[model samples]
Target: MSHRFLAKQWSLIYVRDVLRVLVARDFKLRYKRSVLGIAWSLLVPLAQLAVMYIVFKEILRLTIPHYTSFLLAGILPWIWFQSSLITSSMTIVENRELVKQVGFPIAVLPTVTVLSQMIHFLLALPILAVFLLIDGLRPTLALVALPLVILVQFALTVSLAYIVATLQVKFRDTQYLVGICLLLFSYLTPVFWDFSGIPEPFYSIFMLNPMACLLTAYRAILLHGQLPAAKPLAALAVLSSMVLSSGCIVFLRARDRFVEEL
Candidate 1:
């Protein structure tokens, strides 16, 4: 509720330090009492890949070459997207004491959530690389575009995080709703299956999902060794920018009210 604090620029040097500390604290707290510690980050996605591979590749006998690698590529980014939203959605409410006590930019809370999960996502990438090598898949020159893909995904995730975190401060059920939507979204995304079978107008509609476009790009670079087509890539770039700009607008508008709501 302090006007001066609200007026403070979020780009201040101290704000960067606070963001670093908050991200580290979240990362440590996530694994604090665990037996395997950081290993769990690597294990969780690999385990999910195993079960999904078995069910889809073995039981249903869906034949896609190097299916394990394909699944790994999609699942890693999806996990980051899903977990970031789940945790970030409650960040403001969970840290109400800090919100009331601090005058710093409150937006850092959701940024920290996305960054923390990004660490897990990065850790899981080596596993995907190993799978690619084992499958005799050498990444092409198109692999250089991966950083751009990651940037796009990060923008989208953080934008959604900001919106959800700000809203959940007022409506406590937002987290539950996010969970249900993420569950449904997993099926809608091309995580376990190929997008080629989607067919017609539905395929075009599905491509509009930013996550779908992102996952497709990931598979293109890591699995298929090619860049995503310019059309979808351009669409993703436009969408990410819009989401980021709008999310910042929404979060800043709601930020002043967060303390009272909390």
Candidate 2:
């Protein structure tokens, strides 16, 4: 029994080492052959910000105060969530060769994808910081809670990634479906607009969205310079845990048939 326990410990260590290597490779490959490289991460969002600012703020005349900070708080994380899900959904199918030919821990493919995109999300933070400063907002002690907010979002992303990756092994169309759904959902999220103006029933329902809660938490910290209200954070933490457990269970059960499906 002691020998078996020692072997299991080493096995976990080995898997962790492999995960690290895969994440590095995926991160590098994402920008390979691109002229702008990682700058594209910041550029894509900044370009979107420019369009939205022009349309909503200039054309429609939405009177949002400190709009850049508010919008960045939402857009950055939405990009992370959107990009992670879309990429991770295809990871299992994309690595079908590895899934079939190697004795690899297949579940780590989506984990690697999510972590690599997370690095992009983190790299884009300086842009947000610059916007905050431009708006004259200083970093506050509430910034300490930013990590907790990120952890919650990461949990939610990984959980969804696991489920999506597993489904993609059998359903090749899952990636396109994910992209379509995200495009539709973006309008529902409070990314470019203030949630305060939303009416009662819609407001309550919208707040239930994990992304809405997350972006609100981000704005609370970065835009308002205060820690988020405990209620939404607690709710998101619980939701993320439950979803993560379900995702892992689904992925593990489906993994055995992945090679055949591939």
How accurate locally, in lDDT, is each candidate?
Answer: 0.89, 0.89
Q: Judged by lDDT against the true structure, how good is candidate 2?
A: 0.89
1-262, model 2: which lDDT tens digit per residue? 2335434544877779978999888867868889998898889889989988889889998898898778888899999999999999989888888888645777788878888888988999999999999999999999999999999999999999999999888888999999999999998899998887878998999999899899989999998899998898998899899999999999988998997778
Pairs that clash in candidate 1: none
The CA lDDT at 11 in model 2 is: 82
**C-alpha root-mean-square deviation, each candidate:** 1.7, 2.5
What is candidate 2's TM-score against the reference?
0.94
Could you tell me the lDDT of residue 159 within candidate 2?
Answer: 96
- Cα lDDT for residue 161, candidate 2: 97
Cα lDDT, model 1, residue 224: 83
- Which ten contiguous residues of candidate 2 have the minimum total lDDT? 1-10
Clashes of each: 0, 0
